[model samples]
Target: MTREINPFGLRMPPELRELLKREARLNGRSLNAELVARLRTGSDPPDANDPPPRGMRLRTTAVQPRNGWVPTDAERAMLTVFRKLPPEKQLALLTLFE
Candidate 1:
């Protein structure tokens, strides 16, 4: 069953929205429906649950030098505020611009 998620307001660019709609249609679903499906499935979707039929697992890792970056007061405040938000909210903030 679907429920009212945002009763007040949310915003997105018209062109981007149209592009998303077109892509969703090409894949046989609505944008909202696709998002809801992914959300309900958690971080990894259903298809990723089992070992591959080929019995080979693909893995990747990136190694980076540890150069500690000191946080400014503003950065620290923002991190504190951001950490307080729910995972969904954090993901929303991360994706909202991109």
Candidate 2:
């Protein structure tokens, strides 16, 4: 069986073309196959040695404090300041912790 592929032409910078060619060779795929796979996935394929995404890594290490755990004075002060922030400001500050 054959899949119908529409013919399309693209003009890219020489550097980008070379990059795609190199990546295709590294992955043992034809240039057309590499381009098609990337288009389907909407991004480059993940490398096995790459670190997990930031959010995933953060969630994995997150720990829930014991029921008896209490915040230190510094933590309490920080929380107090955080609570005083406006909703938008609070969200912006929270992203910094991420």
Give the candidate number with the greatest lDDT.
2
lDDT (Cα atoms) of all candidates against the true structure:
0.51, 0.58
Candidate 2 residue pairs in backbone clash: none
Query: What's the TM for model 1?
Result: 0.33
The parts of candidate 1 lying over 4 Å away from their true place are 3-9, 37-42, 45-98
**Quality of model 1 by C-alpha lDDT:** 0.51
lDDT of prediction 2: 0.58
Please state the error at residue 14 of candidate 2 in Å. 0.7
Q: Which pairs of residues clash in candidate 1, taking residues 3 or more apart in a chain or in different chains?
A: none
Model 1 C-alpha lDDT per residue in residues 1-98, reported as the tens digit of each score:
35656643448899977765754554457887654544564565334324221111222222232454445899668757866775446556656656
Structural similarity to truth (TM-score) of each candidate: 0.33, 0.40
Give per-residue lDDT, candidate 2, residue 43.
71
